[model samples]
Target: MGLFGSRGRRRDIPNNPALLAAAAENPGGSVAEIDPAYIDDPNGYVPQEAIRGSWLVDSGGKLTGEYEENPRHGVPQDDFSRLTDPDHWLGWLGDDPAAAVRKGIEESLRAQVADAVVEWVKILDAPRFLTGGRRHTEDEQVMLVTRAGLAAAFALSVRSTQHGRSTLLGVFSWVAAHLSEPQGRKDRTWFDLGVGLDWAGERLGERIYELDGTGGTVER
Candidate 1:
């Protein structure tokens, strides 16, 4: 008799014999296809070289030509340097080129988030928080502070995702809970607890380990 319940019954789990054979032959074979553009010149500066493998994908469903882990030519390096350089293209655009470039960057960032913020706010139902408190209904200050905090959290999550550490779901949950209270004043202790739960969920989702006959190992 089977210890779990089944007795003298064939296992229902599907086993791919071909895949098993392939794995046995070539243990390092990857199931996912690596795009050539990303594999070639990940640095972008060295465009002549063959692209290397990358984890970043673009809107077109192609792997980004730029590297994700540690891009050789990236915003913090080349782009920022150019923006700050005296003889750079942006330097020629204005008298106070540095300030102008900074302003332009801010504007661009604001524009990028404008639509996203609107959509997010719509989904959040900001008006619901105004019901109980006179501070929330009469004075716009409470609402403004709440909106700003939520926006800051959203921006932080987006920035974190660029580095492959996305906390959007956590931030969203915290913001939602915060917005549920009257006068838009979130209970920090409660919010922190909620954030912890969200973090646990994230960790659980990323877990790849499974138990086999020998021991526990990473799945795929």
Candidate 2:
């Protein structure tokens, strides 16, 4: 017996009266009934690349936050002054820490040269840092150098992953000319780069590469 006192029969009814009323208003047909208001003009469609800024709006139709600019529209340049500013890096760090490290090195090199683009960015090796006589597992001392156009060097001490972003512990840069043979300095630059080159030669080196005709390097 069912609730309606019928034997072996069930009633198809909505518990909410409002739903029943709403269903009654809809026409019973194979094709779905769509509201004419939903048909939008095709010219209003905006492509992802064309969008530059976006503003946050609340449900009450009120402006919420400031306009945020799209970082992908231009060259990915890190603000030197805000390097240690954690807030600036929020969500900007890509998933791969190694790629971020390589970009940091390449950008630093690229900034120093004119009409020259940095390519074949690689992290030869990353040795862990020592803090107060104790090994800090998170920190890495990265040494990188550039060869073409001009010899530029950069040493980055970074936290591989800190609060979902790579924190820059320190950055050091110099021209390799100061350490070359005639200067009578320890030519350790070549030694360091030699090891990295040897390691890169053995494997398929994953590094930054420039697009065929575009002035910018491929992002990721």
Candidate 3:
């Protein structure tokens, strides 16, 4: 039996392993035939080099390409950066961007989620925001923000994923809990989350995180 907190991810990213490999770097790499290593262990390795349309990933999860002091590339080479570009939205959603706009989530909400993803990346990159000015490696930032970003994604999933109805209460509750964090407090775009917490308070008779009164939340 699995121990407490010893669990699998509700969802694994880069649904397509081949997509994570920068096949172009390998001369003959193509979507039809990606690196054999990725095929064998989709979650075990990643693109060794930066590719035009590839993501940086390893056994643990998705990661961004090398962090830059002055990144000038117009195209994003990693999952985190891709979040900011709507053009990549379709690829992120398995070549079906429209599908991402689902039952309880509208295009606007989807935009917000994407924005949050970008913001989450910045928060992760800037470790000093939480630790009072301490420079950290990109890996450290990824470790810190991956789960939180995924957790925030849960709120979006509550509206978009097939498990929305089943996970509605749980997902919103989880989101609320995260919204109480220092980073969450600093993020003002999550007004939708306030609406969600209000619903929880009105219906569930319980609430863990409350809206910040300083206009960071939209309580109705």
Candidate 1's error at 110, in angstroms? 1.4
Q: Which lDDT tens digits does candidate 3 get at residues 41-97?
A: 333322322122223233343333321121222322223232233222122223542
Encode model 2's per-residue lDDT on 56-142: one tens digit a residue.
323443333323444343222232322222222212223643454455465554454433343223221222111111123465352
lDDT of 1 by residue, 88-199 (tens): 2221224763344334333443454542211110111111111111235666565322210111111111232233221222222211112223454332111111243334
CA displacement after TM-score superposition, residue 92 of candidate 1 (Å): 7.4
Q: Which model scores highest in TM-score? A: 2
Q: Whole-model Cα lDDT per candidate?
A: 0.25, 0.26, 0.26
TM-score of 2: 0.19
User: Where does model 3 exceed 4 Å of error?
Assistant: 1-31, 41-77, 86-220
Best by lDDT: 2
Model 1, position 158: C-alpha lDDT score: 23
- TM-scores for every candidate against the unseen true structure: 0.17, 0.19, 0.18
Candidate 2 deviant stretches above 4 angstroms: 1-94, 130-220
Root-mean-square deviation (CA) per prediction: 22.5, 21.2, 20.6
